[model samples]
Target: MSRIVERVRRVRFTWTHLAALVIALLVAAPLYWMAVSSFKGKDEIGANPPTVFADHPTWDNYREAFADNNFGTYLLNSVLVSVIATILVLSLSSFAGYALARLPLRGKAPIMVALLMISLFPTIALAAPLFLLMRDVGWLNSYQGLIIVYTALNVPFAVWILRNFFLGIPKEMEEVAWVDGASPVRTVLTVILPQARPGMFTAAIFTFTACWTEFLIALTLNTADRYRTMPVGLALFGSQFTVPYGTIFAAATVSVLPIALLVLVFRRAVVSGLTAGAVKG
Candidate 1:
């Protein structure tokens, strides 16, 4: 019986691994094609039956993309906006989450519902109002305008994730800190935060990704050439006459690197955080 059980477990594990590999390949194939096509010559990119690999790989695409698009400036703008927006989102979400999860706050359930509603509200509906507001405040085509908008859009979701993660932690952790004379703020900082590191990392990843890849709001607000993000910059690579797929893909490949590196670096924390929250409220 023991030998039979071992064999069954082994087979199940093998199947699981096989399924995971297949899924990974499916998701990665498009990204792989984009990366490879970035290295191909402009004419080769438009081949009738697209080449799986570059015929003669060259760096011309990268060079031309940067030279034509002020790509470095756009890259810097994207990084600045994303980093600042992410920091604000994470900071605001953490405190709000702790309050909702652990504190004696009134109407917590209703507040959470309200947050979900706000997140679900259509961005397009608010665009005109937001544009006018920014214009009145003289913030159009500015970094601060984009950062604040991104933070507002991202914080609600982050709070929901972190709140659930916090609920999963034992109350005794905070109680112990309180018993030792630590205040609420101190307890949260020294006790809760260290234990909640994974949750924070998870929230950070989502916030950063949302800010990094956000296109619509960025395009709508930052119309000035100097203020535009990479997505906006990449969009202008095509004209009525021609679409330079090779250059666009080259820029896209570079743009994807930062987000990819973030996920790889935080893979363990993100996995634990996501799974931990799944079983909680």
Candidate 2:
């Protein structure tokens, strides 16, 4: 009986491993294709039977991607907007989340509900209104415009995530700080916020990813070529007459690198933040 049970357990583990492997491959296939295609020339890209591996890999795609246009400027804009927006989201969300989690205030429940609902509203619906508002304020085609809009769009989710994480922390932690003669602001700044690093990192990652990939708002807000981001820069690789597959694929691969590195670096914090929020004090 013991021998039979051991064999069954081993078989189950093997099957689970096989299933996970298959799922990983399925998820990685497109990314693999994109990376591989980036190295191929124009002919190999549009081949009748798509080339799984390039017979003659070339750097011309990357060369063209950088040389023929203002890709450097677009990359700089994306970094600037994403970094600043993420910082703003973190700052605002941390304060709001702390208040929502720890404070006694009138209508807190309703306020949280309203914030969640606001986050759920479609970005598409706000495009026209946002465009008009930005235009009226002369914020159109500027870094501040994108940063502000992205921060607003990201804050609700950030607040929700951070609030839950904050709630999971013991109330006694703050009480101890208060007993130490720390002011409420000092306690939050030093005690509560330090313990919430994982949650903050998690929120930052989500906000950065959203801002980095956002296209419609960026496009609608900025019409000037120089102000465009990586997404728009990639789009410009195509024209009325022709679309360069190699350049697109190359640019796409390059675009994925920053985000991938970010995720890899913060993966542990992200997991901790997510699981911490699922628990209640």
Candidate 3:
């Protein structure tokens, strides 16, 4: 009977592992196809029997994309806007999160609810209002407009992440800092903030990804050719008559590299941040 039970447990574990592996493959399939198609020649991309792997991988799509399509400019703009916006989000969210987590303020519950509701509001609904506001401020077609909007959109989520992470930290740490004659700001800067690095990194990564891939906002606000982002420019790769699949795929693959590298490098921190937020004192 013991051996029968052990056998059943082993079979159950195998089936569970198989299910996880299948899910991973399903998630990875689209990314794999995009990356593979990037290297395939134009003819192969459109072939009815889609090539899973390129028989003759070529660099022409990447070359022509950057050279003729202004993809480099778009990439640069995305990087600048994403990095700047992520910095703003982390700085602002860190403070707001710490406050929300630690301080006893009037109407805190209402404020938290409002923030969560605002985040749930669809981006499409804000398009018209945001465009008008940017136009009135003369911020259309500029970097700051994009940066500011991205920061606002991402702050609520970042604040939530950091707030939960902060809650999990020992409350006595703040009291000890106060006993040492540290001002609240100094305590946050020197003692508490350093310990919140994992949460901060998680916020930074998420904010950067949102800014980097944002399309509707980037399109509506930034009209100048030089200021276009990766998503906007990728759309233009296909003309009215011709849609170049290879070129689009190449650009997409290139665009995914930075985010992939970021995740790979700080994956552990991200996991820690996410899991740490799951518990609170």
Candidate 4:
């Protein structure tokens, strides 16, 4: 009986491993193709349906991409906006989430419902009004403008995520802190915040990625080349007359690398953040 159970377990493990391998390949194929194509010349990229492997890889595409576009400026702008937005979202959302989850504030339920409702509102719906508002504030084409917009857009979701996390925390822990003469703010800062790192990290990663890849708002808000983010600036590589596929691919590959690295580095935290509340609840 034990041998049969062991055999069944081994079979299940084998199938699970195979499934994971297949899924990984499916997810990685496009990124791998993009990286490979980035190394190939334009002619090679345009050949028939395109080949997975490059016969003659060249750095010429990268060189052209750097020379043609102010990639540095675009990268800087994206980083700035993403970083600022992530920080703001993390700070504001965590506090709001904690208060909603732990504090006995009046009309809290209605307020949270309002926040969730705002989250459901489409970005396009707000674009016209946001554009007008930004224009009046002279924030068009500015990093601060994009940062504020992105932070506001991401905050509601962040609040919900962190609120769930906060709810998962044992109330006894904060009560103990309170009994020890820690004020509410101090208890939150020293006790709750440390425990909430996983949630904060998750929020930061999501906010950063959203801001980094936000093309529509950036394109609409910032017409000037100087303030354009990577997504908008990289589009310039493809023209009506001739598209530089290799260079475009190279730029895209590079653009995704930072985000990929960030995810890899904080994968554990992300997983914990996502699952902690769910499991606890």
Pairing residues by index, what is the TM-score of model 2?
Answer: 0.94
* RMSD per model, one decimal: 1.6, 1.7, 1.7, 1.9
**Model 2 / residue 140 / CA error / Å:** 0.5
Error of 1 at 7 (Å): 4.9
Tell me which residue pairs clash in candidate 2: none
Preferred candidate (TM-score higher): 3 or 4 = 3
lDDT of 2 by residue, 134-215 (tens): 9999999999999999999999999999999999888998999999999988988999889999999899999999999999
Quote the positional error of residue 122 for candidate 4 in Å. Answer: 1.8
Question: For residues 67-157, what per-residue lDDT tens digits would candidate 4 score against the true structure?
Answer: 7767778988899889988989998998899999988899987887898898888888788888899999999988888889999999998
* TM-score, prediction 3: 0.95
Candidate 3: Cα lDDT at 260: 93
Tell me how far the alpha carbon of residue 143 in candidate 1 is from the true structure, in angstroms, after superposition. Answer: 0.6
Which parts of model 3 are misplaced by more than 4 Å?
1-9
Q: What TM-score does each of the candidates earn? A: 0.94, 0.94, 0.95, 0.93
lDDT of 1 at 152: 96
lDDT of 3 by residue, 1-281 (tens): 99999999999999999999999899899999999998989889988888888999999989878998999999999999999999999999899999999998888888888888987889999999999999999999999999999999999989888988998888899899999999999988998889999998898898899898899999999889999999999987878898888889899999999999999999999999999877652
Q: What is the lDDT of residue 227 in candidate 2?
A: 91
Could you tell me which 10 consecutive residues in candidate 1 have the lowest summed lDDT?
64-73
Error of 1 at 163 (Å): 0.8
What's model 4's overall lDDT? 0.89
